[model samples]
Target: MSTENAAVNFSELVNRNKQTLARLKESPRLLLHRRDGEDLVLTTAARAEQDQTVVSAATRMLASLARREPGGMELLLGILPDVFPWVRFLPEPDLHAFTVELVDTMRAADSLGNSASVAQLLITWQHTAEVHSDPELLAALTRDHAEDYGPATNPRDVA
Candidate 1:
């Protein structure tokens, strides 16, 4: 979809459904902006399926390349910094581990036809890097804690 005309208020779908659908015909996807919560992407089933197909094929190819070639994983590692500069905050060993886990998770996600795990993995790693970025927080997290405060509360139990 063209970025210029790709986004429209979510109300367009509720009030001007037909016009919004027409816009989909011109561009394969639409970014629906919402004031209340997270924005959403609108696209035809065909387009979504096509995107999944591409992701699956590309991921499979990368997996295969990594297995067959000695430097394939290294090649991906070399580019990760450019694509995700936040990764620079991660320690060297963690960076390598992250790359390995990312590829494995991506392959599994593509096989399952769901990218949630991949997104979650990235978020988890990003949070890790964020912690490592802060010295006091990292030390607090890594330091020993022998005393038990209390039973941990479940997030769902909170109002």
Candidate 2:
């Protein structure tokens, strides 16, 4: 089975059901593009399970490496720039914090079979990096305001 994901219009699958199933034989994974909604992924249950297993194993290995080796986390932090170029914008302390959070979140998310959480964490960190990368934004954010804003409200409470 080809490892590459093949994409086809959602209509193609709806109109040519048999042909689409045949395409699956050539490529184990398929991305169904939809005009009006979120795109859908199609793959065999076995393949999905295998992918989850691989991700889980990798997460466990990463956790183990960080725990067992001296200066292990530093080693991992050293490679963050390569994995995410935007991380270069983060200050040294923030960068270290991000790395620790990322590894922990990855391990937790993988264990729960919830990759979405990992993705959200990355997005949140990337946006933080973006702010740090912009000189004006960083200065504006860091500047002290004399104005006393009233009580702070918890975001969770608003919802």
lDDT of candidate 2 over 1-159, digit per residue (tens):
687989999999999999997888889788999999999999889988999999999998888888788988989988889999999999999999988888899889987899998899999999999999999999999899999999999999997
Q: Which regions of candidate 1 fall more than 4 Å away from where they truly are?
A: 1-5, 34-38, 146-159
TM-score of each: 0.81, 0.89
> How do the residues 104-151 of candidate 1 rate in per-residue lDDT, one tens digit apiece?
999988878889999999999999999999999999999999998999
**Cα lDDT for residue 50, candidate 1:** 90
Clashing residue pairs, backbone N/CA/C < 3 A, model 1? none
Query: Model 1 TM-score?
Result: 0.81
Global CA lDDT computed for model 1: 0.89
What lDDT does each candidate get?
A: 0.89, 0.91
Model 2 misplaced regions, further than 4 Å: 149-159
Spell out the clash pairs found in candidate 2: none
